[model samples]
Target chain A: MCIAPVDEMRKNHMTMLLHQRDKTVQQGIRGQPASLTGCIDCHVTPDASGTVARSDDEGFFCTSCHRAASVKIDCFECHADRPAEMISQLDWKSLNPINHSSLLAINQQSFPYALQFRLETRSMALNQ
Target chain B: MNKIDQYRRKFLGAASAAFVGITIAPGILLQAGNAATAGQGVSDAQRWGLLIDTNRCEPGCDACVQACNKENGLRSIHGPKTDAQWIRKVSLKNRKNGHVLNMPVMCQHCAKAPCVDVCPTGASFKRADGIVLVDKHTCIGCRYCMMACPYKARSFVHEKLTDQLPHAPRGKGTVESCTLCVHKIDRGDNTTACVQACPHGAMMFGDLNDPDSAISKQIKSLGSQQLRKKLDLDTGVRYQGIPV
Candidate 1:
C-alpha cells in the first residue's frame, strides 16, 4: 500500500514532502511518511531494457501526471529521480567516468563511504 | 549544463543517496539521555565534531577530498576559480626548518560561525547539534556568508546544478560548504565520508559534547587545537600534531 492513497498523495504530496524536508533538515528526524528519495525508490523503476524514464518522458512517474496538468516538477532538478542502487546498476558505458561517481559500491553495501577507495580506483581506471 | 553533464549529475546524485541503508553505528543508542528517540532528533545535547590526526594524514593522498566530492556530488566546473571544493588537502611549510604539515581542511563548523552571522536571509544557520549549514530554500545567493567565513570554507554555485544528491540539494545562486554530511548524520550514520575514507584512520568523529565519546576522549588524551583559535569561533573540528 502507498503511504497514502494514490489520490490523496497526488493532491497533497508537495505539502507532505516539504514538511518532511523541514523536519529532516532542521530537526534531524529521519522517520517520516514521505520523502523525495523514498518516493523515487517506490514510484520510479527502470524498464527490462535497462532504461529509466527521464522527467520529460510522459511515461515517467511524476511526469505522467504533471505533464497533463502542465505543471513542471522542480524537485528532480536537484534531487535524483532514481534511487542510488539503480544508478549503480546502470551500465558503465552510458555513465561518464569523469563527470560522475556512478558504478560505485558494487561490492560494499555498508555505508556510502565504505567503498570510496574502490570508486576512486574504478573512476581513475575508467578515465585512462 | 549539457545533456551528458545533466545525465551524469543525476547518476552521481543517485550514487550518493544510495548506500545510505548501512547498519547504524553501535553506540548511537548507547548514548544516554537522548536514548529515547533512537538518534532521531538534533539537539544541543549532542555537538557533532571531527578530530584530524595530522601525523597520520598522508601528504599527497587525496582520498578524503575524493570521497567528499563523491559523497556530496561536487564536480569541478570551470577550474579552481569556480570549483566547489567542500574539503581540500592543504600543506603548511616552515621556512626556518622546512617543517611540513598536510591535512584536510573544510568548514570548521564553529559555534560562532561567521557565515551564519552574515547571512542576510537567515539561510546560513547552525543546527542545535552544531552542524553549520546553508539552507538552500531561503538562500538568495547574496554571497555575504561566503565573504564572512574565516576558514574560506563557503563556495558559491555559479553554474546551474542538475541532479544534485537528494539529501544534499544544492543549486545555482546559492552558497554551500561542507555540510559535515548532515544527511548521513540525520539518518544515524556516525561518521562522515572523509573520516570513513581515511586510509590511515587520521580522522575520527563523534559527539563532542559527550565526555565518553571517542572524539572527546581523544581530544582530551591526545590533545588537539582548532584553526584560528584566537578568533574565538569555538570550532567543532580540531587538529592534532601541528608543529610549533
Candidate 2:
C-alpha cells in the first residue's frame, strides 16, 4: 500500500523530492517515479465541497504533515499543489498521456476509496 | 530433512528473495532510466549560439523586443530605467560617415563570463552547452553580476511579481537576464522568441559547434564580430554588417 516504508518516506521524502527536482530540471529527465505531480495526484484530498484542496488548505496532504513537523514547504510558491487536472487544462494537455493513464490505473486499483468518491461526484454531476 | 520441511524452507527463501528484489528494484530502475536519458542532457559537444545580421535589422522595428517581453511576461511596471529589458534594440550611427545601423543586443553568453566569475554565491553560471543562467534559488539579490557584465545584460528584480509563467519563474530580488530562451532550448526548440519574431531573418539560432549549422556557416562565410571582442569573452552571440 505504501510506496516505501512509512518510516523511510517520512524521514527522507524531502531529500528524495529535491534530488528528483534537480534531475528533472537540470538534466531534462521526465516521467521519473518520484515526480511531484505523481505524488500530488495520489495524495491530494478533496475538501467538503468535493474540490481538490490547495496547498494552504488545512487538510492538504503535504501541508498537513509539514505543518505538524514544523517544516515550511516552499514548493507550492511556484508549483501547483493540487492534481494537474485541477490546476490548468494546458498542464493536462502537456502531461505525458501514457504516464497519466498508467497512474490512473494504479490509483484506481490501489486507492479505491479516493477514486470512488471522485467518480461518484463526477457521475452525479454528469447526471444532473 | 523431511519433504514438508524442505518445501517450507524453499518457500521462505523465495519470499525473501522477492522482498529484496522489490525493495531494490526502483533504485536500480531509476539509475538505468537516468543513464538512458543522459544523452539528452545539455553538453559541451553543442554550443548553441546566435548570429544577428544587423544590416538587415530595421530601425523602429521592435518586434524582437516585444516578442521577448510577451514570451517572458515582462512588463514595464516601473519606468524604462527600472524595468527589466532582456533584449533591446540599439541604434548606431557613424559620426564621420553618416552611416546608420540598427541591432538587437542581449546577454552575450560568454565562454568565460565575468558575471559567473564575479558572483560570490555562484548563482550566475554558464551551463555545459554554453548558456549563461542565473540560478535564482541561490541568488542573494547582489548586483555584482550586473556590474561585471560588459554588455549591461543582468537586471535586478526590484518589485514583486505576479502572474509569472510557470516555466519562466521570476521573483523579487533576483538578478535575471536573457537566458537565451533556455527553457525553450531544453524543450528541444532551436529558435528563440526574437529569432522567431524577426520578419527579415535578421536573427539566426543554431549550434555553433556544428559546422553545418546555419549560424556556424554564416559566421564562417561572412565573418561575424563579437561585441567588445577586446575583452575576449568569446560571446555566443555574433553580429554582422556593423560599421566599424
The numbered model that scores best in DockQ is: 1
Off by over 4 Å in 2: A1-11, A24-61, A76-128, B1-40
DockQ of each: 0.12, 0.04
What lDDT tens digits, residue by residue, belong to model 1 across residues A1-128? Answer: 78998799889998999877765665566656687788888888889997888766788999988878989767765677777786545443332222222212211122122133224323211111
Provide the clashing-pair count of each candidate structure.
0, 0
Per-residue lDDT tens digits of candidate 2, residues B102-219? 7777899999999999999878887767889887767898899998887777788887665455556677888999989876887677789999999999999999999999888888
Give the per-residue lDDT digits (tens) of candidate 1, residues B1-244. Answer: 8999999999988876664533243234223234213435566788999999988898767788778877877766665556677875665544445556667778999999988888888889887789999877788999998778766678899887654565677788888899999878766788999999999999998999999999999988988887766678999999998632
Docking class of 1: incorrect
Off by over 4 Å in 1: A90-128, B1-40
Error of 1 at A128 (Å): 30
